[model samples]
Target: MIVKMLHDAGLRSEHAYLGAAASIGLSLASWLASNRQENLERADRWGIFVGEWAPTFFGLGLALANYERTDGEQLIDSQ
Candidate 1:
């Protein structure tokens, strides 16, 4: 129901959480893939650490779906 909260609060799905999900996933994936190149230092390690945020994004997407009105939040919406 988080998404409904966001929506009721005047936030658009595609503009906020949805966009955040895509952005975080892409960033995390790229960071993870790039980390396999060589010995990464502390900063690079931090990058990899930060790259693991994709699942959180996905979870937020789930919350958004749960907040949906129709059919108890269909997961297969027009994503």
Candidate 2:
């Protein structure tokens, strides 16, 4: 249901996948930037926090893709 609502709102699987990729880059950038200004522990924490988002985004992307596939199958069958 949530996936359908997200799809209806124009949020596709590609967007989620892209977001996951971007999050990984952002995490690396954040780690580098923070390492220059803060302690190593803090930098590691910052990187880890940002890195965690990638998994959620990936999961969403998979769910959306599955939904799209099944939905497409239903549409074809109904015709």
Q: After superposition, how far is residue 43 of candidate 2 from its true place, in Å?
A: 0.4
Summed over model 2, clashes come to: 0
Q: Model 1, stretches more than 4 Å misplaced? A: 1-3, 12-21, 24-39, 70-79
lDDT against the true structure, each candidate: 0.59, 0.98
* Per-model TM against the reference: 0.44, 0.97
In model 1, the number of clashes is: 1
Residue 17 in model 1: shift from native, Å? 6.8
Q: How much does candidate 2 score in TM-score?
A: 0.97
- For candidate 2, the lDDT comes to 0.98
Question: Cα deviation in Å at residue 72, candidate 1?
Answer: 7.9
lDDT of 1 by residue, 1-79 (tens): 5566676886543444565566666666666666676555643665656555655556665665555545344655754
For candidate 1, the 10 contiguous residues with the lowest summed lDDT are: 66-75
Model 2 over residues 1-79: C-alpha lDDT tens digits? 8999999999999999999999999999999999999999999999999999999999999999999999999999999
Best by TM-score: 2
What RMSD does each model have against the real structure?
7.3, 0.6
